[model samples]
Target: MAEHTIHFGILGCASIARRNSRAIKLAPNCSISALGSRSLERAKKFAKENEYPAYVKLYGSYEEVLDDPNVDVVYVPLPTSLHVKWAVLAAQKKKHVLLEKPVALNLKDLDVILEACEANGVQYMDGTMWMHHPRTPKMREFLSDSHQFGKLKAIHSVFSYNAGEDFLKNDIRVQPDLDALGALGDSGWYCIRAILWATDYEMPKTVTALREPEFNEAGVILSCGASLSWEDGKLATFYCSFLTNLSMDISALGTKGNLRVHDFVVPYQDHVGRFYVTSDLGWAGIPEGADPPPTVHSIETDLPHEAHMVAEFSKLVENIKSNGGAPETKWASISRKTQIVVDAVIASIAKGFEPIEIN
Candidate 1:
C-alpha cells in the first residue's frame, strides 16, 4: 500500500506465472495483488500453491483483474493468441503491462498492444528476463569495445530443449489454436532477441529461414533456423527447437574479438552468470602459443534476473504513478523490434524459405 509500490495482477496461472510470482515477491516495489484465470478454482489453487500473500485477491476472469481499482500492473502470461486481446484491454484500463515474450503472434498484433499502452500512458515491457541480468551489460561493454571486439561480423544463437512425448503431443505450444507459432515463438524468441541485442537492435536487411523446419501434424513449428543479413555485411544465424537437447549458446564474432555464452537465455546458476571473451590475437603458431584462454566474466546478483526485470519494470510504473512521468519507450521499442524480426522469420518460412525483406 506504499505510495511507491506497484500492485500486480497476474492474468493467468500458466506454468511460467509461478516463476513470475516468485519474481514479483522478490521485486522491491512490487506485490502480487491479484490472480485471475478462466476457472476460479484453478486460480485459487495456483495462488495457494505459489504461496501468494493472503492479501492477494482471486478472480474468476481476466476482466475482473483489469477492473480492480487497486491493480497498477498486469502480468500477461496468456497464450500468444490471447496476448493482444488481454494486453490491450489491460493497457486501456490504465494498468502497466509486463507481457511474456514473443509479445504477439506477429508485429501487427504487438503494435496494437503498444499503441494501447502509449495511448493510455501505461508502461509496457516484455518478459525477456535475460536483459536484466548484469552480465548482459558487461557483455555489451565488451562487444562495443572497438579495440577488443572490433566490428561485429557474424553471430550465431541456438536455444533448444527436448520436450519429450507429452509436450509434443499435449502442450499448448504445439497446439494450433493456442500457440500456433510453436517453438519459433516459445523458444526462438530468445535467440532472435539475443541476436538483436548484439547488434544494438539494428534490424537485419533480410531474413531467410533455413530449409525444412520440423512441424507437428497441426503444422506448428517444432524446430527451425534462419539466417539474417544486415546492410553492412553483418550476418547472423539462429536455431531453435523443442525436439533437441537443452542447449543455449550465442557466439558473436567480430573482426578482432569474439564472445561466447553457453547460457544466454537462462544461466545455470541463479545468483551468478558468466560469459567468455577472446580478444586481440588469433591463429597462434604451433610452437609459440595460442591466445590466452577466453577470459571468464561472472556477474553476481542479489536477485534472479526475473526479479530484476520485475523490479526495473515496477520502478518505471512507480515513477509514472508518483511523479507523473511519461511511460518509458525503450522497452516498447525493443519489443517491437524483436517482434518485427520474428514476423520476418515466419514470413520467410511461409514463402518457401526465400529471403524476406525487413521493411
Candidate 2:
C-alpha cells in the first residue's frame, strides 16, 4: 500500500463493468489488473475491446479473480441475482468489494453480504456514482442552511428511459429471475437514495406504492411509483419506469426555499454539473423590482461522477490496507437504507398498494 497502486479484478463482462473499468483506469490509486467472465472468450474480447494493458489477466471463472493473490479489490457488476454469491465470496477471500446496485434481492440477503464483508475486514460500497459527485454536496449544503432553506417539506423525483421492445424482451433487468425488482431496482434505486440522502438518511415512517404499476410478462415490474412520509409531515414521491423517455429530475421544497436538478443520476455533461436553488421567498407575489431569477450553481470536475466514485472508494481501500484501519461503515449504511426503502415499496405493491410501515 505504501508505494503500490490497488489492483482491481472485475468479475463479469457486463455492460456496466466497462464503465467501472474505465473509472479504475482514471483513478490514480487504482488499476485494472484482471477481467473474468463465465466464457473465457468473452473476457478476452472485453479486455481487448476495452484496450486493457497486456499485463491484465483474463479468467474464465469469477472464482479465479477472487483467488488471484495480487487482486486487492473485486468489482462485481454482475446482475442482482449473482451479487450476493460473488460479492460474499470475494469478501471472504479478503478482497475489498465494489458491488453494483440493487445490492441484493432484499434486506435479509443484503445483511448477509454485509456481514461477510465485516467478518473479512474488507470495505463494501455500491456503485452509486451520484453520491460521489461534487455537485451533490453543494445541494446538501444549501439544504442544511437554516437561514436560507428551512425545514424540508417535500421531494419529487423521476427517473425513466424508453428501453424499447427488444430490451424489454431480452434484457436481464426486466427478466424476473435475473432482477425481480426490475424498474424498481434499476431506476428506482437512485430515486430512493436521493430521497433518503436529502433527508440525511432518516428512515421514512411509512412507504406507500402508487396505484397501477406497469409490469412485463413473467411478472417483473416495468414501471412504478411510491410515496413516503415521516412523522414530522415531511413527504416524498418518486417515479421510475422503463417505458418513458430518458429523464432524471428532482424537485425539493423547503419552508423557505426550493431546489431543482434536472439531471441527478448522470449529469448532461461529465465535466460540468448544475442545479437551481431559490431561497428566502419574501412573498409569493412579485418582488420589489424585476423578480430575481433562481440561483444556478455550477460545479466543475476534472473527471466524471463515476470516476470520482471509483477514486473515493479506492482511497478508502488504500487507507485500510496502508494504515491498518477498519472499513468505513458509512457507505454500507447508506446502501442498506436505500435497499430498505426499495423493499418497502415492493411490499406495498404486492400487498395491494397498501401502506407499508418502514421497519
Candidate 3:
C-alpha cells in the first residue's frame, strides 16, 4: 500500500455504489473514509453489509461526506437527476468526483458539472469501468494502425439486458423524474462512448434515431437505437435496450480490416478480456481455408476493471495532491462528447425519429 493513500467518501447507498464500494477497497491506494445516506441507520447497515472497516465514518446526509476533511474523493452513484446537484457541489468542495454514468440528464447540466470540476481543480470521471481495462488500449492500438486497419468505415455496438418486470415497473431507471433518459441514458451511454472512442472522440455530422423508441407510460425510453455518420464516410450504429437478452458487443470495420468484441462493456468473467481482429479483404474465400482468420487476443489482469478504474482515479488524485499536478481533463472531455451524442439521440427521437444535426 502507498504511504499516502487517498480517502474515498461515498454520497449515496445506490445499488451501484455497493459494487464501487468493493472496488474502492480493492484499490491499493484508495480506502473508504465515509458512507452517507438520507438515513444514518441505512449507512450503518450498508457499511455492515459491505463489511467496511469499523473506522469508516457513517453520516445521515450527503453534505456530511463532502464536508469531511478526510475525504479526498467522492464517489457519487446517485440517479441522473441528482447528479448535477451533488457532482457540482462535490467539485465546489474541492473533492475529486467519480460519478455514475449517464453523466447528466442533458448536455447543459453536464457542462455545469464539468465547469465546476475545472474551476475547482478537481478531477471528474464518469463510471465507465471498461475505459480503465488494459484490453481497451490493446484494441485501440489496432484501431489506430492505419497500415493494418486502414480508414475506418463503420462500427456497430449493442448493449442490452432483460430487466425483469419488477425492475421495469419499479426501478428508478424507468422513472422520468429520476432518470429521464432511461434506457438510452443507461445502456446507450456505453454504445455512444464506444463509437466516439473508436473515432478518437470526433463529433458526428448527424445523429438519427433508428426506427422508433419504445416508451413506458411515463414517456421514459425503454429501448432505443441511433445511427451516426461523419463527412469522411465513417458511420456507426448502436442499439440499447431494457427488453433483450444479455448482450454486449462492438464490431468495427475498416477498409482493410475489422475487429469484434463480444463483451466490451463488462467482461464475461472478471480479470480476463478478449477481442478478435482480422486484416485482409480483397475478396472472399478463393479456395479451402483461403480466407484469413481473426486473431484471438486475450488479456488477464490482476484486478477487475472496476477496481482498475478506482486505482487509476487514485493515481491522478495522488499526482495532484503530492506533485502539484493539474487534474486530467481527458476523462471529463470524453464524457461530455458522449453526453452530446446522447442528447442528440433524445432530440432525434423527439422529432419523430428524424435526423438531428450535430454541431
lDDT per residue as tens, model 1, 1-359: 33227899999898999889999998788898999999899999999899887889999999999999999999999989999899999999999999997689988898999999999999999999999998899999999999999999999999999999999999889998989889999999999999999999999999999998999988999999999999999999999999999999999999989999999788899999999988875566233564457888999988999999999999999899999998989999998888888888899888999999987
TM-scores, each model vs. reference: 0.97, 0.97, 0.96
Runs of candidate 3 exceeding 4 Å displacement: 1-4, 281-292
RMSD of 2: 2.0
| Residue 75 accuracy (lDDT) in model 2 | 92
| Cα lDDT over the full model 1 | 0.92
Lowest summed-lDDT stretch of 10 residues in model 3? 282-291
Expressed as tens digits, the lDDT of each residue in 1-359 for candidate 3 is 33238999999899988888888888888899999999999999999999988779999999999999999999999989999999999999999999999889999999999999999999999999999998999999999999889888999999999998999999999999999999999999999999999998999999999987889999999999999999999999999999999889999999888989999988998879999998875565346765557788998988889999999999999999999999999998899999989999998888988898998
Q: How many backbone clashes does candidate 3 have?
A: 0
Candidate 2, 75-120: lDDT as tens digits? 9888899888998999999999999988998999999999999999
Cα lDDT, model 2, residue 11: 92
Is candidate 2 or 3 superior in lDDT?
3
